[model samples]
Target: MDAKQYANLIDKELQEMPLYVFYYTQQPNLSVTTIYQYLTEYRRFFNWLRETPKDIENPNAGSISDAKSNKEIKLETLKHLQASQVQMFLKELSIKQNKQSTRDSKKTINRTINALRSLFHYLTVTADLNDGEPYFYRNVMLKIPLIKGVKESISYRNAKFSPMLYTGEKKRKWIDFIENEYEHTISTRRRSSFLFNKERDLAIISLLLGSGIRVSELTRLNLKDVNLRDRSIIVLRKGDKKDAPLIADWAMPYLENYLKIRKQRYQPDKSEQALFLTKYAGKAKRIATNTVECFVSKYSTAFPDGNRTTPHKLRHSLGTELYDKSKDVMVVATQLGHTGISATDQYIQQTEVEKQRIQLDKTK
Candidate 1:
């Protein structure tokens, strides 16, 4: 087959492969997001495959920039791909530049490899990988190990490289900003259901900024998940059933107020099992992940420069604050629902006062 036909065939197959593996395979509880990300990785690989220098009878291969004689990509080529090619692909992700000389970040490169690993595992075991013909990529992909502890420095986006983790004055300023500026602005705004939304937004923002709740965890919460009496929430972190994360006492008032308004706003019969609902629709429906992101985008203006005010940022802010107050790794771990200390360690940051003292002692 010529390059153009092969390219068209490959694109069509790659698109169908993930769904076939996801649904037809016997795996359970894999979230939609994981499948989406894996599909993205497949697209990235195939895009580069078009430019690979092998003499595949593909006509469009020349259309890809800098096509060379050393590489080739095709459905038939996948099974033949040895470990060396896989390693080269993974390495190229971090170092390879586009026409603009831009490269993927260390974090993204790592994730892309993970996605490849998953897809290749599927290709190895499945019949035709949902693309009408059987592909035996298992030998190649399953053998490809994760890249780790490499001596080379990882590339990252320098433009927005500052830690999103809030600390000290930045942390305190945000707390006050949300409490005073955000809460007050919403409370006083001349809009319908201002009180209802303010109460709800405060509860959400406070929960994220106070309890270190992941935005996914926050969205997944149900009425049964919350314990108003003990101010605790039973959150399913990373899809595992775990002990409930406790809510801050101060955030309770907002939760109490929001629940009261939510009940009044939505009819009991039509309301879904979602803890957070949208009022924009006549029928109160669950707030989607996109809604949660848009909500953060809407209120991000309240934060000062250097403080990126996304939901994850708020969680980091709260985690750092909790660590500062408790000085306990377990405390941070339990609240954030992290299974390990290494994961929780990233959340804990030195307060400005502590940093200042350390610097003073350094001179002394």
Candidate 2:
């Protein structure tokens, strides 16, 4: 087959492949969404190769004159791809011009690695064998090692703000005040909308603190996902096909109140199924994730002493609270919809203050 046809064929096979096959075959526990994403990335790579000139020395020679030509490029491009080239591509990505933050850069690296690994694995297993032997696809795999870097010099005077010395009671008090007093307070400037808006904010914060759901998951919530009678929400956990339990008994009352106001304000049009809505133009009809984030940020700023909180910080607080209260790794894992106990362990692991408290107890 020609290059374009081969690319199309691969895309088709990827799209048609059963996710359960991966579990029974080599890579068990690999999510279908992950596989799809890898395939998409590989397709883009092929498209780039097809468009790029084979010989950069002579740009005008041996190049497809018509931009509209949809014919497949040479198959040699795929065969010629080497480990060095792939490594160079990764390096280029690391230094690529973009607005990505440190966290986003890490995520991009991870995604790129996954995509490259998936492609190479597919080629090794499914494609023709090289040298009549199994070609292990290890070259594309990330070779990350935890290397210790130079430690920063610290003076005794500079070493301050130790977690063991810092009492979190004051911080907790501030958080409590924000939740209890500042969160629900409303102004009379807009009488008709005041109660509705306040109820919405309360429900939003309550869900964040109570269920510890990610902002993305919270935004995707629909009326069907909610179980008012059971006081549970069906949250779409990462890598899961179906929504799982994100129950919060405390959040039910506020949710109910919000729902009542929501129903009254925006009587369900055919397109409106989301739990939240906004009054802004273009978004007047549909609720979005950013809207919820902005709402959370606005109220978070009301706290005295400039305590900067985000929707995600509320999730962290919930996890911290659960860890402190139960001290059970499995319980926290289940509550947070985490696939394993290790994630929960990270949340509950004793801080310096907790360690100091233990030491004080031993002295006592």
Could you say which candidate leads in TM-score? 1
- Model 2 stretches astray by more than 4 angstroms: 1-76, 99-107, 120-196, 241-246, 279-286, 350-352, 357-364
Angstrom error at residue 263, model 1? 2.6
Model 2: colliding residue pairs: 4-72
Q: Model 1 segments beyond 4 Å from truth? A: 1-15, 18-20, 23-26, 44-53, 56-77, 82-103, 123-138, 142-196, 266-271, 304-306, 347-356, 359-364
Clashes of 1: 11
List RMSD in Å for every model shown: 8.1, 9.0
Candidate 2: 10-residue stretch with minimal lDDT: 157-166
* Residue-level lDDT tens digits of model 2 in 199-275: 77777777877788877678778888888777778876776545566656756777888888886765657677777
What's the lDDT of the predicted structure labeled candidate 1? Answer: 0.64
